[model samples]
Target chain A: MGARRQPGAGKVLRGLAMRRPLKEAGVLLVIALTATAASWALRPDRLPLRADPAFYRLELDAPLIDPGPALALYDEGQDLFVDTRPAPPGSLPTIPGAVPIRAASFDDDLLDLFDFLAPDDPVILFGDGNLVPVSNIAARLKERGYGNVRILRGGIKAWIKAQGPVTGTASGKEGS
Target chain B: MMRWLGLFCRLAVGGVFVFASWDKLLHPAAFAAAVDHYHLVPYPLLHPMAYALPLLELITGTALILGLCRRGAALIAGCLTVVFMIAIGSALIRGLDITCGCFHTDGGHAVGISLLVRDLVLLVMCWPPLWLADAGPRVPFLCKKD
Candidate 1:
């Protein structure tokens, strides 16, 4: 009965009672380090960070195009219509002849998709009426040197309302 | 009652750590991107952590689940949770729109209040083993196969 040991004191005392606190911690650290090393050596999909390249930044003040003009561009076939939705173009009724550049794979797929087009190609990107995702894709495209990148004002939903042609596996809603 | 609860806590904590490690281990690139989105870590160390963190999670989680070095595992788990909490908290404070990177390497759950509370609950679960007296039979949490 030298002194009363508080309930909370037991927690503090447990550290002293541990057989080898440093050794235990060291072992855990070693395990973590080893695993890290192994992952570095073994894992194939490790992406390293890099500085931004010399590409021009996309203008934040870029205006959104009306569905009428957007649909007209699609009709003319002079502009490239890009559906930035996560779904593949094949899965959804999209602007006819639109290429699916999924926002998920924005960096890689966008680059590949743009490789086939000219630097001056007028690319109209549309999503599920979400400004953030659609703007993000357009901005990235503009950054990569595309001068004419536009977001459809209300995305696919608006395109449908404007009686634009929507043809795919999910068709029959075009102009109806 | 305490013993049963501690066991449940151990399982819950350990199971979570293990499950969280799987996706990060398989897809380090996605994890690195998520980390980069945080903009906290220097660009150089990002990939290194992406690789190391999952392995640490795997080891501690397994150890905690098996009751091997339970105390040590619990401590490490608690520390990791704290680090995660701080990271999430900082991101929230800064209003950074980034993925939590807690479980999925891929962008599954966006960082927000719910994720922060989940981690806090996990930290609390790591507390019991730290304070309670080791009575009856005691098992060493480290370097003991038995």
Candidate 2:
């Protein structure tokens, strides 16, 4: 009976040992939650509890305009073409009259576009073969109440292939 | 010697997390955008997580640094590091060209193999503080007496 009791005692000790870490973890979680709630409450720029689902939809299902239609819009001189590539101000070749607005600096950069562009303007965003940056900017523009934003299909490469009017000197590998 | 090493690991991991949480806390909207780029969190829950995650990091980090609930903090740090590693690894596998948003929400290092390795190293650093008994004297209301 004493020998059998020894194993039970060891089990109890092991359980106690495990309980300490579990208790600590619970305490840590409570502290974190309380801190987070306090911080969120005090911060002036607290994020909205719920995100706009439309933003996600815009990001995932990017509205793309093919080069032919984009070029036609360009010829009509109505839609605003934005170069969304991550490049310096004047380095990258772009569609004539296209505004260079990198998504990384979208908040600061979009200010310049606001001088000439309106919320209702049809804006076409293009990147250097990657659609991710352009898509992000499109979602951002939507958030800012831009109603008609579209991404250029196949990016700048497609625009070049369509013989679209370019402003800067096109390096052979400009969009490749 | 092992105790000193544990202290070092504890401080190192804690300091990094505390530092990393700063910019995200400042520009949480940008951080939300960064997380959205990963496309992991559901859209409805995204903003809340973006708000909460940095706060969690700061709390756990400070706790670890202060040697208060070091084991728990270290465990949370390890868990975060693992999540980070997985996110980076998935990004690399998917060939997504995006900034890490680890330190800065705006323009941090791009997701790559190097970032994954860094997270792995941080994950390793979390081990000692988690397993080793704390060395210093415990404080009232701050640290638990082990």
Candidate 3:
């Protein structure tokens, strides 16, 4: 910063010269050019991890799996249901036995919530995909290393559309 | 070619930060969720930090591109990049699959070695200003690529 002097250009060049080592100059130049090259080497379309081509996204119109499969998984007891969506305003018909965890509540200290389930339980996540409180929660949970966790394709909207049951108390007498 | 390069890079980087901050302003709850996913900041202080940081990003990005406050904007960007690098590094270390939602993006906003490389590039941009400060009173951002 002493280089913050009047007639700043000369001092600045001096500063740069002092900073550059002759032996390292060629190496540094090559490195900088190589870095810029490497940036080009990697395309924007793929995830960097694993280099698995499957990770590359497909066409946006690729037909998504219907929610019937997810609903079957939930009904079969093969998948533990977790609702990552926000609770509706009043009594809402939620799939019975599905655990409703606010997506807002999932975070790094996931161990705090680990007690919610058995470690090895197969878990399927349902969210209101169009309103992403669900998928975001699932993504965060996946971040926490939940191996068997998955986001329900097209989310719960697909469920109701699949003829999956939504439980609401007729009298608002039963708690969902 | 260089001018186009400069213009594009400035727009891409500046646009990204501004876009990221917009969600924080509009959807405080979602923004809070995004920040909390990182788990670095404590829960109690998380909300304010979430609210302020994105707005800071937005202002700084706007300043950088508009050339209204170049040095300060660059510094803010550099600092945010460093913080993001740290946060992503922490997620990797902790074994989190967290997306780098600096902009509230939902798709796997991939993180890994690429993230480190990305930030380092932005960090290098900080050097131009320092060099320019020494050269003389100059424009906030160089359009050398432009």
Candidate 4:
């Protein structure tokens, strides 16, 4: 009896840690299992060919100081400024010489950009307030073999705030 | 022993499928959007497939999980998994970057290489268990007196 075996410290620790009140323990178990199942069910089997979000976003090769640099690029004809942001009541005050490409409904505008712009032509992407459409367009264009793709870091507001002025192309139709 | 395994298989696989189907059926538009995100199927057929798929997933999932008509249900589920794998594999090969949208939408996750890996793993898990059971063979065991 004096020499009777004792449980290991690890076992004791596990027992102490695992020992929850029955009711609470039951709920915890169910939740744990559910999470496990959900993760297992949703995990993908393969990788996407184009997995880089940054790559999908088209940006300028030049320094991004706001939309100002982007505006400058628009002026220099360095890159095409595809503004998916629709007009704000007044005409589109997009950087002069920049094309009007609304961020939304890409399938429509991309064709026009393709018709007018050259492949090696640089593209600066911006959304209304988000890069979703622009990123989406960048990804699609890359898929279509477009070589020069870049997203303006902060979109139009960044440009306007960063000493960037909208020049050229006074015709601001609601390019919805 | 076989009977117990069948029951286990039915509940495990079927319940998942049933719930998966129910969620999608509740919001077909969202599910369709999910399918569109996959880019495996084109626009024209996306709606029609979305309309029909959830129902199919539900019925087969229920049948397999409930242990009723399991043989047929398991076969269908297996086939569906195969079709999905092919579709997803083709999309990956074609350089489509979209979520598989297997369970829920609002999918922001990038389509990963894991997609193919996970599907291949699931196929391995599902195929063997499904092959052993004969049509309704377990039904007799259930009703049999001990």
Give the best candidate by DockQ: 2
Candidate 3 residue B113 C-alpha distance from true site, Å: 1.4
Q: What is the TM-score of chain B alone in each candidate?
A: 0.89, 0.95, 0.76, 0.76
For residues B22-91, what per-residue lDDT tens digits would candidate 3 score against the true structure? 7655544445555666767665555555455665677666645664444445556767789989998898
- What ranges in model 2 sit over 4 Å off? A1-15, A56-176, B135-141
- DockQ scores of all models, one per candidate: 0.25, 0.41, 0.04, 0.02
Q: Best-fitting candidate, measured by lDDT?
A: 2
RMSD of each: 13.5, 14.2, 16.0, 18.9
Model with the higher DockQ, candidate 2 or 4: 2
**For each candidate, what TM-score against the reference?**
0.57, 0.61, 0.43, 0.42
Model 3, A15-113: lDDT tens digits are 665342232333323443453344334533211222222212222211123365667776677777777666642355566677766755555234545
- Residues A40-112, candidate 1, lDDT per residue (tens digit)? 6665433443422111122333456767768788888898888888875477778778888876887777667
The segments of candidate 1 whose C-alpha lies over 4 angstroms from its true place after superposition are A1-15, A18-22, A45-176, B133-142
- Residue A75 lDDT (model 3): 67
Candidate 1, residues B62-146: lDDT per residue as tens digits?
Answer: 8777776677777889999999999999999999987898887645788899999999999999866543443113345435532
- lDDT for predicted candidate 2 compared with the true structure: 0.80
Shift of residue B6 alpha carbon in model 2, Å: 0.8
Candidate 4 local lDDT, A84-112, one digit each (tens): 56664236555545565554555676676
iRMSD for every model: 3.8, 1.4, 16.1, 14.8
Q: What tens digits encode model 4's per-residue C-alpha lDDT throughout B10-62?
A: 66667767777766665554566567655556555565566567666776676
Model 1 chain A worst lDDT window (10 residues): A51-60
Off by over 4 Å in 3: A1-176, B1-12, B133-146
Q: Give lDDT: candidate 1, residue A105.
A: 81
